[model samples]
Target chain A: MSRQAFSWGRLPAPEQRLIKLASRFDALPTTTESLLPYGLGRSYGDSCLNSGGVLVGTRGLDRYIAFDRDSGVIEVEAGVSLGEIIELTLPQGWFPAALPGTRFVTVGGAIANDVHGKNHHRAGSFGHHLLGFELLRSDGQALHCSPTANAELFAATIGGLGLTGLIRRASLQLQRVPGPWISGSSERFGSLAEFFALSAEAETASAYTVAWIDSSATGANTGRGIFIRGNHAEGPNSTATPKGIRLPITPPQSLINPLTLAAFNALYYWRPAAVARDALWHWQPFFHPLDAVQEWNRIYGPRGFYQYQCVVPMQDAETVIGEMLQRIAESRLGSFLVVLKTFGSMAARGMMSFPRPGATLAIDFPNRGAPTLALLDALDALTMAADGAVYPAKDARMSPTAFRQYFPQWQAFARHVDPRFSSSFWRRVTETEVT
Target chain B: MRRILIMGATSAIAEATAREFAALGDALFLVGRNPDRLTAIADDLRLRGAAQAETWVMDARELNAYPALLDEATQRLGGLDTALIAHGTLTDQIAAQASSEMMLAEFQTNALSHMVLCTELGNRFEAQGHGCIAVISSVAGDRGRQSNYVYGSAKAAVTAFTSGLRQRLHPKGVHVLTIKPGFVDTPMTAAFKKGPLWATPATVAKAIVKAVQRGKPVLYTPWFWWPIMQIIKNVPEAIFRKLKL
Candidate 1:
């Protein structure tokens, strides 16, 4: 009925801040019992949320602190989103070392999750590129920490779910790109085995490698996928090519479905199976194809979907991924774009941070009621049994047990941060305890 | 808990409305088609501290799917307190004139979709006996201009639907509001120039939230757009036909 609208998830008590210093003062809780800090509110799950306690909004405090063009390093307010950073840096030929699917995510979010990207196998995670950050401790003290200083806090803060302290600002190393163009190639694979082989081969030559799996397939063809590999192009090849088509608007998700997707895919696959080996392409096409369609996520019918992204060690990928897909298909929960990427080394050792030397699979499943949740639970178990972890950015459902099993560091992370630091993701994971 | 459902979860206005409610500690249900973006927005809302935030990735234009989705959303969020019907389409005038299919499609998306949404919302809100509905109609709907009458006609219909629903639901304690944004720089109007006066997402969001809180029956986002559109609407047909919007 007419109830007071609360956020769709449980979060810690929140405090809206207009100044940057508020976020930098680590433990500046209104009271001794409350403590939590968040960036631009980008973390998909509660990793950045805290309930009944202090939640520092970083949105108001965004500002470019400093930049070293020679070294390609930038220091900005923690609230600054990657999008903001890119807008300011892209023209200068600097890019984030690692990015999640979207540019709207904040630097603090990237650091808190130690986010990875399509080029994760080659560049590692956002943590690798981070030089230092300002940490506001639970006691309300701002401490500048890096690998060399306050090493524990630094390590703890990275992928620490914002527990160790509020990140006020961060100095991140920027990637130097030759140009804004990428030379790309797309190859279709008939099976998971081929996909894996192609991915491994592409890793050796391409700057970025990603695969789209057909999760609906079963049996011998359970994991047929499409392989996309790309490398940054050196110079402009085309005298007249659109810089890139950014989605002016995202078509309603109804425009895409199994039938439409099938047609779209069929047409998509028909483009010579491979395109410009060394042709110039805008950075948007190379990195964010989905960005082309603004609000493209609406395609999932009214039954919203969950993005299930998990990284299984390469050794266990085939068995674990095969079983995961098998379960999804058995449940009849179809996924439109099933992406597969190889993770490189982890840059940070934060608990719950998802990245490792393995293969990560991401899929979307419309919420088909209890069956979907049950299926996801089963899949989580499978992922954990294989020592795989889930991506916090793309996660809506993952129990505390699953979180604990996957991220053994959760306890330390939770304990180190303010006890009040919580989120919907955290709430869902820890629902039994609070509810 | 304040239970809010954003129908067009991915719309720029919808996203901003979501952020507003989310920042206010409401439980949010993001209903839209792009499950991925909805999921992303849900995560964002969650991270921003929604008491709880979830997504329903469904095509709003598919009326048949509304009841089932609403049932699930109500259960998930506990219940609905407020619903923001923000889904819309700015049909290309040239394309609509060129093809009958395009014209009908625009009407279906802009007009029929709202009809279904309003029907479902009216039923639920009436049954609940208390709720609020804010529909995003365009100022263009004030009077169909030759530039985009197909789209304007559809919005005009929505504006009427919302008005009638408001009249019927007032006795039931449900508040219905019509939001007419004039050239808000949304994804829908990205191609159009700012043309002297255009509102931003934040401006529209702020206005909508204020109106909802203040219980305003209907509001023009920029306020000035009201008189501006009124003048255009009141202009004689002969005179209107001779001028460009």
Candidate 2:
């Protein structure tokens, strides 16, 4: 990951790897240069980025070194995508312990973000499953590190946003599922109060839970959503084998407007109840519904969209979540989908992981204009008031002050790994303090 | 995340490609001859959600200037994961035939520029031992036609260069992708008639993204053009000359 700097949006900063790699040279070049270290390119902001330098894109280095079928242990390159892993491992009755909303992310990215999934309450974040990794230091040395070996670097590298070093490969454990199917049920909630109650109650038993809110809904109906809870199908008798179906390509002009999404959400809110665990389902429908349609992200249009996700502690969950919904509705910057879930445990290993003892909410809104920024600012305030913080993976608008306020322990991690401070995300958020 | 760099950043197709990559929040280095356009496009890319976007303005035709320029771009973008050479010129074949100066200029811009860019990119990819290179060529390069062979010849050179480059680079962790666009509707091709097969800039961008993700070695823009050009390439010389294709 040797590069000089990275950029996210209009922001720019020098990468740590660039500084380290350059120092190794017998004579340092006068001109400033850098390289951007990239993980599956799934981030919503420039956190895992560097620009105006050499970019060490790790996507193609994907290779599955070994997979212990019996123990569900897997060793793979940092660039190995979750989709590739799932395609190869799921059929063998093994699955990642935790995953982000999408399956396109690389293992390096998943580790960087310390991503949590629907089963976060049950299995925790990716850091929990991560056992070790091959780290390519700024000086070009490949050293293997684990909990017992270079433990601080391992902890810092997890959720470190590729600032510590280049993650060459990772070894982790996979979970064995009873079947590819999930026995899921949906219940409608009319308000934030109902939503929180239902979510908390469901967390006690369900292995997976998520809520879909209509960001456009206002007043009494604001935050109204369909709460979904699911557990792995008990056995083969619980469901049938799934079939393969793919939408080859996305139409060049599929507009996902308020009207279109409204109709879709209405059906989504009602349709889940229609199939009340009558039969077995395919994993694609359950896990990667968006994958069915290739390039589905294009539906956001040329301007694209930003996904804002924040986790609010239980103490301030109601007011924070309610105020966020109210502000979003008032802003009129509508979102196609708003998901809510509760995270039960924390992966202490990751330096900057997002999850905590709180209810996490993710809302995707098309970039309309200034109102979008304004709304996000307001949401940030509300989340902060609730003792919450935003997800770094899906964030593009968070301020350094906000980041500092949210992650007070950042200084410790920053000093430990990249004391000189080399990372686009670090440069942008803490411009004055980083380098 | 994918780290993508576009050497010809200001082109319509490159702008669209930048937007697509930006949507994925990829870090990008947009290089071009015009600083204003590069900065403007980079700003626009950021607004569209690029995690990072930077601009570099330099004459791509100056092969000697590439190593430094590339060094700057790579430093700016972090490291080069993939570099897409979207730079090329569209010259009038009749004008080229009328003047040797016109032919030389066209060849420099269309073929030589890409050659230099590809060589530098290929070396970096090889150094890393893993990366992808996507270059935008023309379907006309598959076989020369009487109407635009001058431009076709340059593209043909680029096409042949890319094929050999791919063979050498692919073995060393670099995946070379050649995009042969038949008739893309852009400022360069606006004078031509628009037809079903003539793709929009956005379509070309979409196809390029798909090809990179799929790791396809070579692809015709619309996919159908692959078969169309196959038949065209195999056509008898006598019959091909009589046809106005």
Clashes of each: 60, 46
Error of 1 at A100 (Å): 1.7
- DockQ values for all predictions? 0.02, 0.02
lDDT of 1 at A98: 85
Q: Which segments of model 1 are wrong by more than 4 Å?
A: A1-41, A48-55, A237-267, A270-276, A346-351, A430-435, B1-245
The prediction achieving the highest TM-score against the true structure is 2
Docking class of 2: incorrect
Clashes of 2: 46
Task: List the candidate 2 regions with Cα displacement exceeding 4 Å.
Answer: A1-32, A234-267, A270-279, A416-423, A432-435, B1-245
Kindly list the per-residue Cα lDDT of model 1 for residues A1-435, writing each as its tens digit. Answer: 111111212212233221123223223546544445656554543455444444655664354666666788988878778877776666667788887777767788788888878888788888888899987765556788888998777887788766666787799999987766778777677777787888778887887888877666667767776788877666654434334333343234434455555555546544574443545557776677776654455456434466778889889898888888888766666666778888876554554567877888888776566877888889888988898888776676687677767777666666566454555456667555522
> How accurately is candidate 2 docked according to DockQ?
0.02
Please report the interface RMSD of model 2 to 1 decimal: 19.4
Name the top DockQ candidate.
2
Task: Report the TM-score of chain B alone for all candidates.
Answer: 0.96, 0.96
